[model samples]
Target chain A: MWTFLVTEIMFFGGMFMAYIAYRHAYPLAFAAASQKLNIILGAINTTVLICSSMTMAMAVHSAALGKKNLLILFLIATLLLGGVFLGIKGVEYHDKWVHHEVPGPNFEFEGADAQHAALYFSLYFGLTGLHASHMIIGAVILIILIVKASKNQFSAHWYTPVEMFGLYWHFVDIVWIFLFPLLYLIDPRK
Target chain B: MSDHIVPVRVYWSVFITLLVMTVVTTSIAYIDLGPFNLLVAMTIAVFKATLVVLFFMHIKYSTNLTKAIVISGFVFLLVMVFFTMCDLLTRNITAPGR
Candidate 1:
C-alpha cells in the first residue's frame, strides 16, 4: 500500500511541477484558468470524501471490536460514499465538457492565457482521472470486503483486510487534498 | 472477548480532523499568497496525509520494520519531487512562453 501511494504521489508530483512552472510563468492565465473549474462541485466532493473516510474508519473500528452488524453498516456506508464521490466527479466532468474546458481539439478559452489553458486542462484531467481510478479501486475493494464481511469472515484478531483497505482509501483522500487547490482555487479573484 | 476492540472515538476523531484540514487548506488556497500559496497548500496536505497514515493506517502502532519502510519510501519520494522541481523551475521560459 505504501509503495502504491508513493507511485501515485510521484505521478501527481510530476504534474505539480508542471503546474508550478506554468503558474510561475503565466500567473494570470493560471489564475483565470483555475477559476473556470467548478468550486461548488469540488467542495461537495470534499464533503462526500470526508464522509467516506469517516465510514471507512468506522468500518475498521467495528471490525476491530468484532461487531459484525456495525462493520457491515460502515462498509455499506463506505460503498455509498464512494458512489456519491464518483457521481459528483461525473457532474464536474460534465460541466467541463459543456464549457469546452476539457483539453481536446474542441477546447475554447477566453482568458488572457487561453493558449496555455491547455496546461490547466492537462493537469486537471491527469490528476483527477488518476484519482477517480483510485476511487474505483477502493470501491471494488470494499465490495469484496462487504461480501466477506457479510459472511462473518472478519473478527477482532483478523481485520487486516479492513486496515489495508483503510490505507488505500486514505491515500485516495490525500490525493484529493492536493487536487482541490490545483484545480479550483487558482484565480482567487473573487 | 471484551466488547472494546478498537478505540472508536479516537479513530473517528482523527479522520474528521483530516477532513477539516482539507477544507482549511482549500479555502486558504484561494487567498493568493504569491509563491507561498503552493507552499502552504502542500504543507497542509502533508499534515493531513500524516494524520491518515499515522492513525487511520496505524503506522504509529506498526512494527519497527513497517515504520522504517514507510519513512524511507517517503524520503525517497521527497527527493524525487525535489530534484524534478529543481530541473523544471530553473528553466527560462519567457513570458510569451518559450
Candidate 2:
C-alpha cells in the first residue's frame, strides 16, 4: 500500500509541478483568479475533510482493537463526512459555472489578465476535480469496508484493508490541506 | 500481530493540532505578507502534511523500509520541482546580447 501511495504521490506531484510553474509565471493573474473562490466554503470543506480523517483514523483503530461495531460506526461517519465534502464541492462548482469561471469558451474574467486568470481556473478545476474523484473512490471503498466489517471480517489479527484505506483517505485530506490555501486563500487581503 | 497500535489520545492530539493549523493558515492569509505570504502558507501546509503523514498515516510506527520508501517519494518530488524551476527560472536569462 505504501508503494501504491508512492505512485499516487508522483501522479499528483506532476500537477503540483504545473501549478508551481504557472503561478510563478503569472502571480498577479493567479491571485486575481483565486480571489473569485469563496474562502468560507473552502474553509468549511477543509474542516469537513479534517474531521473525516479523524474518523478514518478511529476506524482503523477500532479495527485493530477488534471492535466491530465501533469500526463500522467510524466508517459510516467517514463516509458521511466525505459525502458532505463532495456536496459542498458541487455547490462551489455550480457557483463557478453560474459565474462562468470554469476554463472554457464561455469562461469570463473581468480583469486585465483575463487570459492568465483563465489558466488559474484551469489548474483549479484540474486539481480539485482529481481530488474530488479520489474522495468519491474513497467513499466507495468505505462502503465496501463497512459491509465487510459488518460481516466481522476484520480483527486485531488482520485489518490490513482498513489501515490501507485509512492511509489513502488521510492522503486525500493532506492534498486538500495544501489545496485550500493555494486555491482559495490567495491574496485574500485584496 | 506485531503491528504497533497507536493510542487514541495521540490521534486526538494530532487531529486537534491539524484543525488549529487550518484556522491559523486561513486567518494569516489575510495579513498581506508580500512575498512571505506564499512562503508562510506553504510552510504551514508542509507542516500540516508532515503531521498527517506521520500520525494518521502511521509512518511513525512503520518499519524502516516503509519510511525510506515514503521519504524517497517526496524527495523525488522535490527534485522534479527543483529541476523544473531551474529550467523555467533560467529561460528568461539568456546571454546579454541574445
Candidate 3:
C-alpha cells in the first residue's frame, strides 16, 4: 500500500511542479484565474473531505476494535461525504463550463496575459480532475468494503483492508488539503 | 497484527482543527498580505497535510520503515523540483547566438 501511494505521489508531484512553475512564470495571471474560483464551494468541499477522513479513520479504529456495526456506520458516513464532495465538484465544473473556462477554443479571459491565464485554468482542470477521479475510485472501494463489512468479514485480527482503505482515503484527503489552498484560496476576491 | 486504535475524540478534534484552518486560510486570503500571501497559504497547507498524514493516516504510530518510505517520496519529489527549477530559473533570455 505504501509503495502504491508513493507512486501516486510521484504521479501528482509532476503536475504540482508544473503548477508551481507556471504560477512563478505568470503570477498575475494565476492569481486572476484563482479569483474566479468559488471559494465557498471549495471550502465546503474541503470540510466535507476532512469529515470523510475523520470517518474513515474512525472506521479503521472500529475495525481494529472489532466493532462491526460502528465500522459499517462510519464507512457509510465516509461514502456519503465523498459523494457530497463529488457533487460539489460537479457543480463547480458546470459553473466553469457555463462561464467558458474549460481552456479550449471557446475559453474566454479578459485583460492582458489571457493566454497565460488559460494555462492556469488548464492546470486547474488537470489537477482537480485527477483528484476527483481518485475520489470516485475511493468511493467505489468504500462501497465494496461496506458490503464486506456488513457480512462481518472483518475483525480485530484481520482488518487489513479497512486500515488500508483508511490510508487511501486519508491520502486523498491530504491531496485536497493542498489543492484547496493552492487552487482556490490564492486570490479570494470578495 | 494488532494495530493502534485511535480514540474517537482524537478524530473529532482533528477534524475541527482542519476546518478551523480552512476558515483561517480563506479569511487570510482576502486580506491582501502582499508577497506573503503565497507563503502563508502554503505554510497552512503543509500544516494541514501534516495533520492528515500523521493523525488520519496513522503514520505517527507506524513503524520507522513506513515513515522513512513516506518521507523519501517527498525527498525525491523535492529533488525533481530543485533540478527543474535550476534549469527554469537560470536560463539566459538575451542569448541570441547558438
Candidate 4:
C-alpha cells in the first residue's frame, strides 16, 4: 500500500510541477482565471472532503476495534460525503461548461491574456478531473468494503483492507487540500 | 506486524485542525499580501497535509521502514520540482540569445 501511495504521489507530483511552472510564467492570467471560479462552492467542497476524511478515519478506527456495525456506519457516512463532494463538483463543472470555460474549441475568456487564461483553465480541468476520478474509484472501493464489512470480514486482528483504504482516502483528501488553495484561492484580491 | 490503534480523540483533534486551517487559508487568500499570499497559502496546505499523513494515515505509528518510504516519496517530489524550477527560472539568464 505504501509503495502504491509513493507512485501516486509521483503521479500527482508531476501535475503539480506543471502547475507551478505555468503559474510562474503567467501569474496574472492564472489569478484572473482563478477569480472566475466560485470560491463559495470550492470552500464548501473543501469542508465536505475534510469531513469525509474524518469519517474515513473513524471508519478505520471502528475496524481496528472490531466494531462491525460502527465500521459499516462510518463507511456509509464517508461514502455519502464523497457523493456530496462529487455532486458539488458536478455543479461546478456544469457552470464551467455553460460559460464555455472548458479548454476546448468552445473555451472562452474575456481578458487581455485570453490565451494564457485558457492555459490556466486547461490545467484547472486536468488537475481537478484527475482528483475527481480518484474519488470515484474510492467510492467504488468503499462500496465493496461496506459489503465485506457487513459480512464481518474486518475485525481487530485483521482489518488491513480497511486501514489501507483509509490511507488512499486520506491521500485523495490531501490532494484537494493543495488543489483548493492553488486553483481557487490565487490572489483573490485582484 | 503489530498494529497501533489511535484514540478517537486524536482523530477528532486532527480533523478539527484541518478544518480550521482550511478556513484560515481561504480567508487569508482574500487579503492581498503580494507574493507572500502564495507562500502563506502553501504553508497552510503543507501543514494540513502533514496532519493527514501523520495521524489519519497512521504514519506516526507505522514502522520505521514505512516512514522512510513515505518521506522519500515526498522528498523526491520536491527534488523534481526544485530542479525543474531551477532550470525554468534561469533559462533566460543562462541563454539570452534563445
- The TM-score ranking, best first, is 4, 2, 3, 1
TM-score of each: 0.88, 0.97, 0.96, 0.98
lDDT of 1 by residue, A1-190 (tens): 6676667667777766676767777777777788777787887787788778878878888888789999999999999999999998998889999999988899899977787877778877887898899899888989999999989889889888887788789778877866776677665646
Residue A40 of model 3 has an lDDT of 88
Kindly report the docking quality category of candidate 3: medium
Better of 1 and 2 by DockQ: 2
Per-candidate interface C-alpha RMSD? 2.6, 1.0, 1.2, 1.0
**Per-residue C-alpha lDDT of model 4 across residues B1-98, encoded as one tens digit per residue:** 33788999999999889889988998888888988888999999999999999999988888999999999999999999999999998999899678
Over A76-169, each residue of candidate 2 has an lDDT whose tens digit, in order, gives 9999999999999999999999999998999999988999999999999999999999999999999999999998889889999999899999
| TM-score of candidate 3 on Cα atoms, chains taken together | 0.96
- After TM-score superposition, the amount by which residue A188's alpha carbon in candidate 3 deviates from its true location, in angstroms, is 5.2
Per model, kept true contacts as a fraction are 0.51, 0.80, 0.81, 0.89
A106 Cα displacement, candidate 3 (Å): 1.1
Worst 10 residues of 3 chain A by lDDT: A181-190
Tell me the whole-model lDDT of each prediction, alpha carbons only. Answer: 0.78, 0.92, 0.89, 0.93
TM-score of 4: 0.98
lDDT of 2: 0.92
Worst 10 residues of 1 chain A by lDDT: A181-190
Flag clash pairs in model 1: none
Residues A138-167 of candidate 4 have per-residue lDDT tens digits of: 999999999999988887999999988999
Per-residue error for A147 in candidate 1, Å, reads: 1.0
Instruction: Encode model 3's per-residue lDDT on B53-96: one tens digit a residue.
Output: 88888888889989999999989999999998987787765456
- Residue-wise C-alpha lDDT for candidate 3, range A111-185, written one tens digit per residue: 578899899999999999999999999999999999999998998899999989888888888889889889997
